[model samples]
Target: MTSDDVRHRREAGHFVRWALAQKIARDLSFPAVRWNGPSQAMDDEARWATARRLLHDDTLKSEDR
Candidate 1:
């Protein structure tokens, strides 16, 4: 799930809604903080790059065991 920032700016379009919906689907039992505003204009490629980096970092850290 995203932080309060993402939630407050997710009503601009379907992508934000989709993202929020995905977050909601992850853990419905928890207190849901729904997004309700316009989505940020970001580069999808950059976002994916960041996600990849994070995943790789975690993977490498786990391999240190």
Candidate 2:
């Protein structure tokens, strides 16, 4: 493969990783505003727990991402 293809592949991989993370975060819970603060997302522990449950990695296309 060409260098351009390699670069695009890496970029797409990064996007998939991020998108999956966001998807998991959303699946975990909706952000809630604290009594006197801004809205907060699921805790780190929750996030990691979600990550641990994943069985495989998805290699998505740029459009899919």
Which one wins on lDDT? 1
Candidate 1, pairs of clashing residues? 7-35, 11-37
Candidate 2 local lDDT, 1-65, one digit each (tens): 22544545545555556766878434332223236643678798977865655533355443443
The local distance difference test score of model 2 is: 0.53
Candidate 1 ranges with C-alpha deviation above 4 Å = 1-40, 58-65
Weakest 10 consecutive residues of candidate 1 by summed lDDT = 24-33
Per-structure clash totals for the candidates: 2, 0
Tens-place lDDT per residue, model 1, 1-65, is 34555653334445545656888444323344466754886599977886787777755665552
Q: What TM-score quantifies how close candidate 1 is to the native fold?
A: 0.26
Question: What is the alpha-carbon lDDT of model 1 when measured against the actual structure?
Answer: 0.57
